[model samples]
Target: MTEPKNLEVCGSVMDGIAEKGSALESPSKKQPTEYTVYPVRWVVLFIFVLYSASNSLQWIQYSIIQDAVVKYYGVSSIVVYWTSMVYMITYIPLIFPASWLLDKAGLRVTTIIGAFGTCAGSWLKVFSVPQDMFWLGFTGQTVVAIAQVFILNVPPRLAAVWFGADQVSSACSVGVFGNQLGVAVGFFLPPMLVRAQGTIEEIGADFQLMFYIVAAFTSVLFVLILLFFKAAPPTPPSAAADLGSNLDSNFLQSIKKLLTNRNYVLLLISYGLNVGVFYAISTLLNQLVLTYYPGANEDAGRIGLVIVVAGMTGSVVCGLILDKTHRFKETTLAVYAASVVGMIIFTFTLDCGIIAVVYLSSILLGFFMTGYLPVGFEFASEVTYPEPEGTTSGILNAVVQIFGIVLTLTYEWMLSNISDRWSNLTLCAILALGTVITACIRSDLRRQAAQNKG
Candidate 1:
C-alpha cells in the first residue's frame, strides 16, 4: 500500500464514518474516474450560514446588555459577566461532545439544535425579574453557546469534505464571511430596534424584549435550514447513500493525534490566547471605558455597536485576503500584533481623549480580533489532514473556548477590583504573548508542509 502521508486520511476512517450516517461519503468520491471538483452547494451553504447567524446575537449582544443589565437590574458586574461568560464556560466543556454529536448526527441536526438553544436563551431574556433575568440570560447564553459550537465546527468541516483542495480555502473564506455578516446584522439590529422605541428601558420592557427580537429572527433562519440542508453525498463509487457510523472512533483518535501535533498544539495555545484577549476585551469593554473616562455610560451601547461593526468588517476583509493568499500564519500573526498595538495605545491614552482613543483603538482591535478565529480555523483544518473535517475543527474550536473560560474569569476579576486601564493593559500583554507564541510555531508549520510534500 502507498505510504500514508497523513495517517488520519486512511480509507478505514471513512468506513467507520460510513456506519455513522452523518459522516456520509463525498458524492465526488462516488465518481472518482469522473472526479472533477464540484461547485459548492450555495443554497445549503446559505441555509447553514443563516443558521450560523444566531451566534452573532449571542456574542455581540453582550455589549448591548452589559450596561442595560447593570443599570436596570442592579446586578453586579460579576453577575453581568456571567451572562456572557456562561456561554463560553458551558461551550468550552461541551465542544468535544458537541463535535461528537455533529459527526454522529450531522450538521443539519446539529445546527437546528444550536439555533433552538440560542433562540431559547433569547426568549428567556424577556422576564422582568432582574435576578431571574440573570439566570435566564445565563441559560439563554448557554444554549446559544451550544448553537455556536455546532455552527463553528460544522461549516469548515463540510467545506473540506465537499470542496476540492484548490477550493477549500475559498470555501473556508465564505464560511467566515457568513459568520461576519451575522455579527454585522446582530450589532446593527439592536440600535435600530432601540431607535424604533424611545428610551433604552422602555424598549420592550427590558433586555428580554431584545431577546425576543433575536429569537424570532433565529427561528426564521431555522426554517430556512429545514427548507434546504443536505448532507454531502455518501462514500464509495457506487454505494447507496450510507449514513456514517454512529460510533466515531475517529473523533477521539483525531483529537489525540491533533493534541500530539506540535504545530497544532501551538496554534491552539496562540489561538486560545488571541481569542481570550478578544473576549476579555469584549466582556469588560463598557466598564473599561467607564473606569478610565467616567460618565460615558449612556454612550456605551453606541460604542459597543461600533466595535462589533468594525470587527465584522475586518473579519470579512481578512477572510477574502486569506482566501486569495493562503498566507494563513503570517496574516494571523500580523493581526495579533495589530491588536497588541491597538490595546497599548488605547489603554495608555484613554484619559487624554476618551472618544478618540476608544474609537481608534476599538476599530484596530476589532479588525485584528475578528480575523483570529477564521485564521485558526483554516490552519486547524489544513493541519488535521484526513480527519473527519468537522471533528478537527470542533476540537480546535473547543480548545479556543477553553481559553475563553480562563480569560472570562480574569475579566470578571479585573472589573470587580482593578482599574480599566490595568485590565486593558493586561489584555494587551496577553495579545503580545500570543504574538510570541505564534512566532515560535511559524517555522515548524512551514517545515511540516515541506515534509508533507516530500
Candidate 2:
C-alpha cells in the first residue's frame, strides 16, 4: 500500500481519499476522483422539500376556507386575510437576518431553526381551535410566517450544494414545486375538510381537524429533519459547489456584490412582480371567483387546484429545459410572455361565468406565473455565482414579499371600490411589465462570459 499525497487543484483540496483502493474510490479505477451521484443527497433534498411543503400548507390554510374561518371565528374578512398576508409581511424584515444565519451557521442549523419555529407555530394553532380565539390563530400565523423566511430561502442554496451543475435548475425546480404543491394541497384540503356552506359548529369542528392534521404533519417533519438532515455532502457535488465551498465572504460583502449585478437587479424587479401577482391571486382566488361568479363559490378550491397543478407541471418542464439548454434568459422571456397572454385571457374571461374559459385561463395563468419562480431563482444564482445562494435568493424573496404586500393591498382596495375585472386587469398589466423587464435582462451565460473575460 502507498501513502497517497495531497494536492490542491483549482483551489479544491484533493486528498488521499482520491487514491485507488481507498474507501472513497470510484467504481471505475481510471477516474477515481470523478464525482458520482450521492443517494443521500436526494434523501436530504426530499426531506427539505417536504419541509417546504409543510410550511406552505399553513400559509393558505385559512384562505381556502376563508368564509368559514371568518364566520367560525367571528372575524372580519381583513382579519382572516391577514393570516396569509402575515407571511409576506414577516418575511420582509426577517429574510436578511435569515440569510445571514444561513451564511454564518450553514444549512443544518438554519433549517432546524426553521423546523422548530414551524412546529411551535403549528402547535400554537392547535390550541387556537376554540371558537372566539381568532387572536390565538393570528398569533400562530405570525410565528409560522417568520419561520417561512427560513424555509423558503434555502432551496436555491440546497440545489447549489447538493446537485451537480447539470442538475441545478431541475433540482431547484423540484424544491420549489414542493412549496407550490403544498399550496395546492392547502387550497384543496381546506374546502374538503370544511364545507363552504357548513353551519358554524360543523365549520369549527372541521377547522379543528384541519389544524390537527397540519400540526401532526409538521411535528413529524421536524423530527425527521432533526434526526437525518446533514449539513452537506462530505465531498463537493460539482464545480459550483467546489467553488462555493471556498468562498468565505461576509454577509455584507455578499449583499454588496449581489447589488452590483445588473442582471440580478433586473431579475429582482421582474421576478418580484411575477411572484407578487401569484401571491395576490392565491390569497384572493376565492373572493375573486365568488364575487364574479356567485354560482362558482363552491368551485373555488377546484379552480385553485387546477391552476397550481398546471403551474407545477410547468415548473418541472421548464426546469428540465433549462437544465438541458442552460438558456435562462430565453426561458424566462418565454414564460413571461406566456404569463402575459394567460393573464390577459384570465382578465377577460374570469367574470364571464363561463366555467371552461375560466378554468383554461386559470391553468395557463398558473402555469406561467408559478413556473417562472424556480427559473428566476436558478437564474439569479447563476448570474451571482460565488455569492452565497441564500443571500441572492433571500433578497429576491424579500423583494417578492414587499411586492406581494403592496399588490395584495392594492387588489383588496380595487375589489372593494372598483371591480374584480379591474383587479385582474391590474395583474395583467404587472405581468406585461414583468415580460418587458425580463426581455431586457442580459443572459446569465453572457454575464458569466463577461465576468470571465474581465
Backbone clashes in each candidate structure, one number apiece? Answer: 16, 0
RMSD of each candidate? 6.3, 5.7
lDDT of 1: 0.61
TM-score of each: 0.80, 0.90
By lDDT, who's the top model here? 2
Q: Write the per-residue lDDT of candidate 1 for residues 276-390, one digit (tens) a residue.
A: 7767766666676666656565455455556666766666666667655656677777877887887787677666765866677667766777756666776665555545556
Q: Where does candidate 2 clash, by residue pair?
A: none
User: Which number leads on TM-score?
Assistant: 2
lDDT to native, each model? 0.61, 0.78
Predicted candidate 2, C-alpha RMSD: 5.7
Worst 10 residues of 1 by lDDT: 7-16
